[model samples]
Target: MTRVLNFLRRPFVLDLRALALLRIATAAVVLTDLAIRSTDLEAHYANMGILPLHVLYERNWNAYQVSLHNISGLWQIQALLFLVAAGFATMLLLGYKTRLATVVSWLLLVSLQNRNPIIGQGGDDLLRMLLFWGIFLPWGRMYSTDAGRTEPKPAAYSYFSAATVAYVVQLALVYWCTALLKNAPEWTTEGTAIYYALSLDQVLMPGGRILYQFPEVMRFLTFATYYTELLLPFVLFIPVGVPFWRMLFVVVMYGFHLGISLTLFVGLFFLINMASVLGLLPTPVMDWIDRQVRTRTQRLQPHLTRLSNWRSPVRVNVESSLNLPPKTIQILHGLRNAVVTLLLAYVCWWNLDSIANPSLTMSEPLRWFGYLFRTDQHWGMFAPAVFKDDGWYILDATTPKGRHIDLNRKGRPLTLAKPASVVSLFKNDRWRKYSENYLFVSNAYLRPYYCNYLLRVWNEDSDNAPVRRLDVIYMKEVSLPNYKVATPSREVLCSCETAPPAK
Candidate 1:
């Protein structure tokens, strides 16, 4: 029993340095995500944008959802929250007030995601789960301003606790659950999922254009992709040759997401996915990385020492304020352990329920906790099946002079011809995601907002022709088997008029 327990624990032991890297990478992603979303502050967040506060509350919001961003309609307020989130992210990146910084950062992220979920994708879910698990992990112990004094660095530089177990298990569920959700014939029998995915011209990257030419290669890759997601996650739990497995797992994921980035227009998804596995970098790899950066490390020591000194007084003040008796601290730790355990159980159940597990199901009331913390997730990227519909958007509009134009092309001459690259029609992945969501029958209400926004933005420019009418046209093309292509269909998704010259 003793040997079995020890063996079971090995998979959960994580390198402190790797966790530190995770902290820095996660914080960087948060800041980078903020920067990307900031570019569309008014258009994506404010009342003036495609989704106003009222519309979000009425249509897109969950009952348990909470968003500070939802409290105001002004973009200025949104900007202030963005700045606050950025500041906390920087604190997390530096490991200054590390736990507090992480908590605030997670809260802000959940709030931001709640504000505009339409632009969100699977990567957002992973990032949120990372921060959630991060709250319970001592990831700031090394390569951080909080380092050196928290606890003596273990000889192996490895830490194992309930939190680590939760982290490791959580990472596994991301891929395993995603694979389980992919139950369609495209993934298993037909082996044409990759072909269908690449058929999406709106998301096809430069690499995909060349790769899709080989049908046999695509079929082979589809099986590899499916099995890779399904089986590789199990390797993380293998105790034998643990470090080798961990290293292999990390490398495979790095390559996997790298391949996805090269072939698809998934903004920040690949980067975020790659960052998710950083904590699995084994001790030997970390040691080599440290050796490579030894000189640079030496140069930064002085500054780090100064930072530690600068934070000492703040630390002291905090310790004095909440300095509970030893008994109280012990009880608090026990309570924390209980909470983490419950959360872990809930998350596992949530994933199981998501895939409609035959024997297990979670009660709806229990999901309130997940929604409140934004821990509820669905990793179904192209699951159940790959999307068969692949298309591009055309913002067809008629000018006041009765001349026609395409707002998607900055009011260029209206033509049915597809652009050189359908993927280029989207300004960014957020727009791409929103456009994808816009095609759904349930999201019909979102169409007019996009239509109105496009018309307004296009008409704002003095040089632009004033439009009498505009139509959101989707040139829909379905991916066909045997490398056969479907004829593009012009679907008028939404139509808007420019208020008939202000009545």
Candidate 2:
């Protein structure tokens, strides 16, 4: 038992620099995500948006699932929530009130994600989990405004703790679960997963188009992706040569995500995954980075000194002046540890249960806990099989003047050439996610909502005003070897007419 405890505690001895980097990266990702969502606030968040409050509640209502977003149907309210989320993210970035900032950011992220579950992806899940774990970590031990001012500086590394164990295990489970679920022949025998993924016009980027020309390269990448995911996670457990393996894993995985980012526009998925890998960066790497930064700072010392002299000297201390009694501090620490341990244990159970039975249903208590904390996780990402069908959406509309036009093509006729990047049709990731969901015919509930939303958008626009009717059309392409093309099929999903104002 003692040996087991020690083994589990090993990860807690983390390099503080790595945690600091994680704080910065996570904050940056949060801010970027907020900025992207802000571009189409009404469409993604407001009641008049594609996923109105009524539809969202109807689809996802549960006794335990909660969100501040449900409190208001107004765009202004959602905008306030967005601003509040941004404030928390900014606090996290600056490492001001680091733990409080992490908690607030995580809560806001959960609320926003629950607000429109349809638009969420694996990246959002990973981001939420990271923030959850960040709450228990002393991430502000170094390079943070929350760091001690009176006491001596903290050590470069943190002591081993259960939180660190949870962090490492959670990351490993992501890869392990994803690898186990990918039982498709393409991932094993055919090595065609990458080919099909790149062929998908919806997610494909410019680099993917170029890479599609090389079948052998795609096949190689498919095998590499699967094997790396399947095998690399085991390295985290090896006792000897851990640093070497961990560093190698970080580098390879970071590069893999970079390649994915270039080939596929998966929103913040690549960025969040890359940031998670930063935790595995060995102490030597973190030390080397610090050395490089110090060297650069020394080189620019004169300029920095001049700039510093120009600004008024300000000393802002974060430590509390009223020190609590020893007993009170001990009690608080004990309570915190207990809470963290329980949360980590519950999360572990959920992960193991998911792996044991992908379709397993949680008990009411577990489900409630997951919903309340927004810690629910699903790791099936392109598992079982890669999507064989890929398509683009076209909103066909008829103006009052009797002109038929594709709303996505700036009121041009449907026969006009498709855009080079179909993704450009979406204002943000939320719209892209909704578009992907609408591709499935069985998602009947989304059809009317989306069609009506599109009609409203077109009619509201001065350029395409006085619209008569609108039809949601999907143009689909199936993958073929040697990049062969088949006749595209145009299918109408749903139609809506502009409702005249009440007299």
lDDT of each: 0.86, 0.79
Query: 67-146 in candidate 1: lDDT tens per residue?
Result: 99988989999999999999999999988888899999999999999999999999999999999999988777666676
Estimate, for each residue in 406-449, the C-alpha lDDT of model 2 and write its tens digit. Answer: 88877777663557888777766677888888877667788888
Best by lDDT: 1
Model 1 regions lying over 4 Å from their true place? 1-3, 148-156, 304-331
Clashes of 1: 0
TM-score of 2: 0.90
For every model shown, the clashing-pair count is 0, 3
> Could you estimate the TM-score for every candidate?
0.94, 0.90
